[model samples]
Target: MMNDEQKTDKKQRLIRKGKKVQEPVNTQLVVNIFEGFTKDERDLTQAHMGAEYFRVMAWIKEEDEQETIGVRSFRGFHQFNERLVFPLDCSSYKYIYIELIKVHSRRDPATSKGTVVMGRAKIRLPPWTSRGKFTSKFNLVGLNSDRCVEIKGYLNLSMQLHRYLER
Candidate 1:
């Protein structure tokens, strides 16, 4: 887990990155999480559950809409464990936004700081409606209360929008 200073530094860095560009850069999307069974958990579960998929529900906010977007999808265990990522299909939405925050952490056996991060993603634009690019950073501290094991990341749709609208 990162300290408060670390989180602040990261945000500052991102803001700097956003400001450095001469062309218009879109607002970024952030995603963060602290708790969940790792890939190791899938291996353990496969021994009994016999290869199953898990679904995650994420809350998303687009720049143009007042209502938030709720995305839920099934992910294969092996793919999830290997990639440590969940893909979202947002062809329908004109804009996108996401933020991940930790609710609580327990003190039992004691573990390292939780995984937190900020990510940038590019979704399918037009001709290619199946592929996209995603970049992210991990191991960040909580922004709300300075708690460890929290995750946060964001998406920059303007870059994607530019690429998509380019004709």
Candidate 2:
């Protein structure tokens, strides 16, 4: 019933409203990862850092095709700071796309906490999805008082990472 121009205008207005509701990063939490790694293990981290996008797909018990709940994108990789953060506005989805632009790791056996890490992560939004930032923590676990961390554990944690976005 609407003309092409009117329909386009309506779509644009919806996108603008969604962007207004999106939030960016503000608070942060630091976590410690534990596991021993060899030189080969350290080199493997090179593959973890890059630019990737993750869309949150709904998990259901029935054997039916699940729907996409929402989506988020991030540019990730290993770094001195080892920090990757998403905007507060991107909290609606449970999963995110991690894209690594650059990544590196080290074989140094060092054990410490509260080390400052800096890295950039981006969240991609569909034309209809809202824009915003959400605050979340990178959880970790370690064994004994070792300096090197197990790479498998870190990768697994990211795979199981979930976000509860606010309404």
Candidate 3:
């Protein structure tokens, strides 16, 4: 027979022994899109007209989940100064897909009224960068019928990653 304090101590020790120690988790990714440019060129000449606005869609696709992290809309052709942040487990995601769509409001019912994809880009985490802070340039491309067309617009993006111990 043991006293109450001894019994408590014994239970604590057992619990501590049975508990599995967890290592510090440091896996976090942050992305920032500062600005983009649509140059004045032959391919982008048609895009300038009837272009009400442009939007960016960012998402991460995983084996069991597909998540959209950010969507930003701007009403200009020269610059899209935007900021987006995502708190996600980077290891589980397969790839990050980004699409820049040009929007127009057309009264004609025969045409697709609202949104048209102007550019698309995909990034795989490991090979891109490890420093977690950098700027990248991506060319805008569009699809015409069964062919891919390169537009004269480009997107400038800045990305950062932060890792801290999880509580």
Using TM-score as the measure, the top candidate is: 3
Residue 68 displacement (Å), model 3: 12
Q: Can you write out model 3's per-residue Cα lDDT over 68-166, one digit (the tens) per residue? A: 322343443445566655555546665567777555534222457666566677765543236657778877666554575756467787766666676
Top candidate (lDDT): 3
CA deviation > 4 Å runs, candidate 1 = 1-46, 62-159, 162-167
Against the reference, the lDDT scores of all candidates come to 0.30, 0.29, 0.58
- Candidate 3 ranges with C-alpha deviation above 4 Å: 1-26, 38-51, 62-76, 90-94, 107-113, 126-129
Which stretches of candidate 2 lie above 4 Å from their native place?
1-79, 97-167
- Candidate 3 lDDT at 160 equals 66
Better of 1 and 2 by TM-score: 1
Evaluate model 2: give its TM-score: 0.18
Scored by lDDT, model 1 comes in at: 0.30
Question: Each model's TM-score?
Answer: 0.21, 0.18, 0.59
Clashes of each: 14, 32, 0
**After aligning candidate 2 to the native by TM-score, how far in Å is the CA of 116 from where it should be?**
26
lDDT of 1 by residue, 1-167 (tens): 99999999898778888465444323322223222221222233344332332222233334232212222212311111111222234435442333232111121114344212222222332232323343332222233334344433322222222222112
